[model samples]
Target: MAATALLLSLAGCQCSPSESDTASKGTNAFQRVTGDDVESDRSQWDQVYAQDAYVYGKEPAEVLVENIDILPVGRALDIAMGEGRNAVFLAKKGFVVDGVDLSEVAIRKAKRLAKEAKVEIATINADLNTYQIKPETYEVILNIQYLQRSLIPQIKRGLKRGGVVVFENQTVDQLKLPNSQGIRRDYLLNVGELKELFKDFKILHYSEKNDGKQAVARLVAMKP
Candidate 1:
């Protein structure tokens, strides 16, 4: 949920690798920011999640629900899993789920939501900028509405061979929307940038579209 101020309610279209080939490439190089930056980010999210209700609601992201059939049922890691919507959904679907977020409040709420949903999930409160993702650890990784360019490589390495990664986040075009104010530009993806970031993986589904409320980029890819 990095810099995602608005709720996610977008749909994406399917695209091929050739469709994304012309897009500018993205880097996986580590770009560490100041400690203050990390602290500030966590504080803001903590405030948002401290509310009594879920900021993004309890249902799983539509992208994950739509593509569940293609994902393998096994250990799954939900990155920036804020409030455990997707993580809980995965657990209920028979996956052993682990959710990680920067805010302790979010983690607490996630655990609560998991209990309410009658599913078990592990929660870790950590800053992704510095947290280590164990290599080849998960059968599936879910990244929804969060972007940390530097974490891309770690995500790739964290997946077991043949494992899948489901990712969805705001695109630059989201800025054009009236409710897009306050969303950080750096957290937004370029039209084909999401696909470019995971170019090495077998692209299963990729899309960039404006679903009226927000423009988003969604991808489902499998490690070879």
Candidate 2:
């Protein structure tokens, strides 16, 4: 039964911290995060937020803003939410948003910023590898500037019918650029890889763009 399957998926979700989950700012303060390990990544991101009121700035990503009209304005999830810029933006647009990240410190900052924005959003501090995404529960899911290939299936299952997913992250081509420092090879998507992953879905838009020093892939797809 579909209900049974959904229940099983939810049961498989993980939320505990791993042994590598210790707190320390990484050697390179500006080092890139590849979703390699939750603890070290969390520590680095926490430090980033502690120093900047909004590390990526207060605006929603351009991809999200440009495609905002097509997104269903209901339950939404923001993966690896960082300082909650996108999550807060969605909340303001009347979406009930839930944000998840490995950094408790980042979540704290997100909650504070949400309050400042006069919008409410639920937040969870959990490692992405262990975090269980509730199945078919959200009308929209936003994954920006983070990539975890293993999470693709979960992302598909986490969306409600007619729901959309907006994802953007660096591509393997980024490795060729000198400015693309600290980005791990495995974290970058190969050309056509992002679209191929969601082949069965209705892809509204997809592209690979050279943004300064990094080559990035962006996609907007909907569940059938």
Candidate 3:
């Protein structure tokens, strides 16, 4: 009942259910975007990507680059893959990468960046909340600076048996900083919540650190 009410309230903020619904097909059929918050969220991202320059910069995340060698370089998925920086990097390393984000502007920029870098990456303009992750389909999965907790189960199932997952995002400690990004509390992971969430998997690396710029929880794990 509480979940239902929360969904309703969020939907009221984003868009109508009828407006947000995507086609029900294959794995996408079961998981659907229930409200307007998702759409409103996408609009904000689209605005960000529409800027003259890449907001987060063109480089792939440090966490991703540092752990790239450990990952199995086959089919990869980058969720909330803003501008495809990480996806493009994986493609350069010979991984067939698919990057998904809600903003078409971001996808266009990602494609442009991939072209300039002479690497190939498939980009999907779709909201991750309703995006269907095929089971056992990807050898590596990457999530950076994005938090969609409900997608955690799907991420686990989408990996091949020996596949790896690299995730890095702001931790709850960010809220303590004076000039923090003001991220929603719900989106921030607790001190040990990241490793705990993937406890079933073999955790290779886990850390919580604040470099005086940002506070984050990073995790690298592999499915057995």
lDDT of 1 by residue, 30-56 (tens): 111122466776776676566676656
The estimated TM-scores of all candidates read 0.84, 0.83, 0.83
Q: Give the Å shift of residue 181 in candidate 3.
A: 6.4
Question: 104-210 in candidate 2: lDDT tens per residue?
Answer: 88888899889999999999987777788999999999988777777899999999999999998767876776544565577678998999999989999999987
Model 3, span 27-86: residue lDDT tens? 221122223566666665665457555545667888888898899989999998877778
Error of 2 at 28 (Å): 7.9
List where candidate 2 sits over 4 angstroms from the true fold: 1-30, 34-37
Candidate 1 — which pairs collide? none
Angstrom error of the Cα, residue 51, model 3: value is 1.4
Q: What is candidate 3's CA lDDT for residue 24?
A: 18
By TM-score, the candidates rank as 1, 2, 3
